[model samples]
Target: MKNRTILLTGGGTAGHVSLNQALIPELKNLGFNVEYIGSKDGIESGLIPDSFPDVPYHAIASGKLRRYFSVKNFTDPVRVGAGLVQALNVIRKTKPVAIFSKGGFVSVPVAMAGKLMSVPVIIHESDVTPGLANKIAMPFANHIFTVFKETLKHVPKEKSTCTGSVIRSELMDGSAAKGKEICNFNNDLPVLMVMGGSQGSAVINEAIRSNLTALLKQYNVIHLCGKGNADSSLMDLANYKQFEYVTHELPHLLHMTDFVVSRAGSNSIFEFLALKKPMLLIPLSKLKSRGDQILNARLFQQQGFAHVVEEEELTPERFLAEMQKLQMDEDLLVDAMTNAESPKTAYEMAKLVAAHTKN
Candidate 1:
């Protein structure tokens, strides 16, 4: 009997899982059984199960692949070895024809296991530069897909394709009316959606909170403040809604937003572009990241799709000023977005991946 199962792996942050989330239904429609391998306690553990209750979720041990010196660096290799064995077991039983990895620390072991098992592995890179995990996993992959054309310079060009971004279809189905209702906002005010990534940013949170009173004078605010970061004191503030994290309701909130203030994660910035939302992007500094977000933000700025505010320069005053500037440049930004390349639909992306599956 031919194997029709497709295994998906990636998770540490929400970005790693979101593309898989978008592709799951499309893969199912194409008659492939989909399953996920992720870290036991990573964000994907909750996201995959909550979003697709029936799909099997396999938990495996994973260690963070950090650049900085850490004591765990010595212990993590053992965990990676264990994860590889666990992944091999899952691949043996499931007999997936192919494994698609979205490139996080958890994905490295899975990719290695897939190579060892002779299952074709496909890896996707969402940034201009390949992340460390993806860099390590690239050799194990049969093919690679990149969201940015510039990424080809960093990966093996012969096996890579720049497929652009793949956006979740549900995002386009949101209603502005539902969005307003979700926020319990009534008065006429431009909406500003603030996202600080899945785990939240203390710098962003502090800047927003300090300037909330001034910001309320101009616009309604919807803050996705990350888990356990919500302030109890601000709970009663009118025209300001704060959520620790939002899943299904995100599209609706985004639909109602007139402007966005967010980190420069490629998946997120591209979604904002697709939605024609003018944005002020505060990318993670080079000290905190490999500078991929900085590159992503710069490209968007060059294209006139967004405005950039470096984290080092961010203050309550600067944040508000940038918000005002984003509003002023809204028309130009929307115009630029209108001319930007459309994202590949999940169905199209699914077909592409399906084409690569072993017959």
Candidate 2:
């Protein structure tokens, strides 16, 4: 039997790589050879090879896809063009049955190469609106899976499916006791996990710290403080713990987390929803992003899965108020989350790739 091969592409932010991560083992379980095509130094470079040592990995020239003017813009396209040539060669060599993209700048060139090479391409969009990279790659996608039903309208209707989010099976395996053990928290207090994506958020770190004493009184705080963001002075706080990030232990952390405070990245929030953890989402300000996080936060709030606070509205007082609100409505949020559908989109996607492989 011929090896069924699928090439995965996504990077930049941890959000971009998350769906691809969810799909990796699922594809492997279906007997397809899993490999990744990513930028040489993006987050994918660290995550893919390290997390899935068995998966063959390739690095290619990659350029950032920017929406605004910058001096790097001119040079980046040259890199992007080079990436296309490199990607075309890689796809030709691998002869993958299908290409799956989770939408990042690195993916744009690869998707274009897949189109030129006649390999079927599948792209998953985690936002209500497509990012700059996916918009460019839309013409190449054989199918576009979306996390939100609302997002379908933004893409070619004939090619789009609302598959919800791709959540890894391991994300749901968290045990509260194991989580408590890992974080060294007392069971006497509820655990509150704060995540600000992979690199952490300076704004969130400040807000939490300014209110740390007040917050620690009510809950045991576990802060994923981003790289270089942890404060040594606060290390001695009895009810608080801080780490740069958690990976293998994330499931356990999630299992132990009774409530959450986080930025409203779609991938992260959806995972939190799957765990039925009530959340207070502080979306990245429009000044910081294209306001995707803001939209994501609002939608989750509307669905009763979380409470939303805009960055402009973020303050210690308001943060605590929202936390109080989240605590008061915990049962309702859990009920909403319980009834919510997890499309298990990665499996649906794996089936799609399998069908393409068979054909």
The TM-score values for the models, in the order shown, are 0.99, 0.97
> How many backbone clashes does every candidate have?
0, 0
What lDDT does model 2 reach?
0.87
Estimate every model's Cα lDDT from 0 to 1: 0.94, 0.87
> Alpha-carbon error at 161 in model 1, in Å?
0.3
lDDT of 1 by residue, 1-359 (tens): 22499999999999999999999999999999999999999999999999999999999999899999999999999999999999999999999999999989999999999999999999999999999999999999999999999899999998999999999999999889999989999899999899999999998999999999999999999999999999999999889999999988999999999999999999999899989999999999998999999999999999999999999999998988888888888899999999999999999999989888888
Candidate 1 residue pairs in clash (backbone atoms < 3 Å) = none
How many backbone clashes are present in model 1?
Answer: 0
lDDT of 1 at 171: 92
Tell me the TM-score of model 2.
0.97
